[model samples]
Target: RIGELFEETNGYVYINLQLASYINDILTFLFAFCCFFGTIKLIRLCRFNQRLNLFIQTLQYAGKELISFAMMFSIVFISFICLFYLLFVSKLDACSTLLKTSQMLFEMSLMKFDAHELSGAAPFLGPFCLSLFIILVVFVCISMFITIISDSFRRARKNINNDQEIFSYMLNKFQRWTGLKKANEEERYALIRLEYFDPIEGFPERVDQLLDAINRLYMTQISERSRMEKDEF
Candidate 1:
């Protein structure tokens, strides 16, 4: 039905394809620019510790804006891809007709703007070059996403390890305060009991444990990746 409509309108798919290509290019450029510049600004904000409270607040605000922008950009690009696939893949007869027409237009000098000259000559180059470019861009984008996710995992893992160390340290210190041996399991357990139940200290040991466990679970993949790298090298 869409193909018939497009055919009646005289190969609108060609214009759609060209527009999709340009939009995809623009989106890729914007994604790269935002990721690069936003990362730099975030790093700078992290470095300037004088206004710690205000810095954290501003970071949160900036994060919300970035997330909104990214979501909108992703939605727009993905919609274009979905629409293109529907027209080009689902309606192959119409798509083939449109491609052939485009080629004929290129040959007969019907188009004032030549796609061959646009792509630096040789327009009907079997789609390999354009496909390769798209594949490479997708690969880079995926890699960047993976890198960001991996770093987040690393940070979570480090925080978990640090929390566990702190917990152990506190346990040892409380044991010492109670005049108990560090090697005594009974004494260590008693110290933990006192740290939480004791009205004087009243620390939230269970909450701390839960937070540490959550962080550790998040970091598990990153830690596994690190172990694999170490083993490989």
Candidate 2:
């Protein structure tokens, strides 16, 4: 029945490969547009919060470290491919070309290739050499990659904490200058919440209040000084 319907409708019931390709292209464009729009909004939101901004900066630095690690890994991987080809090129019929050799080595590193295939290719010592390659690639190299990523994450976290400490120190200085008491736990929580809001809209009122308090304190001190001087005369 399905074949009869297709024959009757001249295959119009199903989408052709070209139509599917067009649909895929349109969907990809829409996805890209959404990602670009979302990124802009996220950046605007980050600007309102010191902690978020610092986190983004730390992430950027960590990305640079990851990119460097990737470059080094590529070099090492290619070197291993060349070394494997040189060692077994004559014995292995599959590794007739550099590309084929790289593919074979990559598969072996993932433990997907058959051990017997290596033995068949290079009978006497193939198994031992392949084991060494697996240990070097899968164990040592992969572990180093994970360690590099872990170190980058730790560094990013440390930098973020340092930035927060500096911000807290500055906030304390401002409180002292305004003759205000140290912020209580609740006030600190509120300040943290305020960091996510529009700085220009919400921050100025608090600053203005502090400045008014400072002015009042200064005027009272001046009046007290003048009164004492008059009494002495």
Candidate 3:
């Protein structure tokens, strides 16, 4: 059915022709799968090491900053594109379609578009105003985005350290609960280190008391069982 609509005899079948689109879809899916697999491997590696985990968290925070920036940028960008389209829709060929007008303005904001296109459309004033807009976006808006990301990195770094310490403390507790008490020495030291860095009032003392109580209870039960076995014998 697709072949009938997109027959070869049709003059100049664009690359978006049915068969080509199907192949493109398949390739795009495969590419996406490869990227997903690579990301999973990177996350696994990060989980295996504390430093790598911190780095990945920093990246994640940076990504969140970028997403927020992009959202704000998009609103401003679309507003400007609409203003330009309304101002020179008939004057510029690029503004013939809203999509094209937006694309042209976005490229101009990046200083990537041909200035002559705007100049040719509306002469001197057109290029001048567009140039000013681009300068403002590149210098002011983009600089603010960079600052936001930098701040996010700083906050993420601090949080990552605190989170890792807390995680180590919890992991130690888990091990102790699961009868791996001997492995908790390192965890105990970690908790002590955390106390020095960030004072959690009475938390360390409480955990130590709990552990002691568990040990004493286990010992008392064992002694009672041994006594019972001797009487039965």
TM-score for every candidate vs. truth?
0.25, 0.42, 0.46
Candidates 2 and 3: which is better by lDDT?
Answer: 3
| Model 2 Cα lDDT, one tens digit per residue, 1-233 | 65787899998897346876899999999999999999877875644356576556655766866787678778877887777688778877667778998898888877788788778877766787787777877887788777866676666666554545576678787986797957789777988997777768868899999999999999999999999999999
Candidate 2 clashes between residue pairs 3 or more apart in a chain or in different chains: none
Higher-TM-score candidate among 1 and 3?
A: 3
lDDT of 3 by residue, 4-92 (tens): 65676474554446787899999999999999998888775456357777667777778866887789888888787787888788988
Cα RMSD of predicted structure 1: 29.1
Model 2 root mean square deviation, Cα atoms: 14.3
Per-residue lDDT value at 177 in model 1: 76
- From the highest lDDT down, the ranking of the candidates is 3, 2, 1
Stretches of candidate 2 above 4 Å error? 1-59, 62-72, 158-233
Poorest stretch of ten by lDDT in candidate 2: 44-53
Best by the TM-score measure: 3
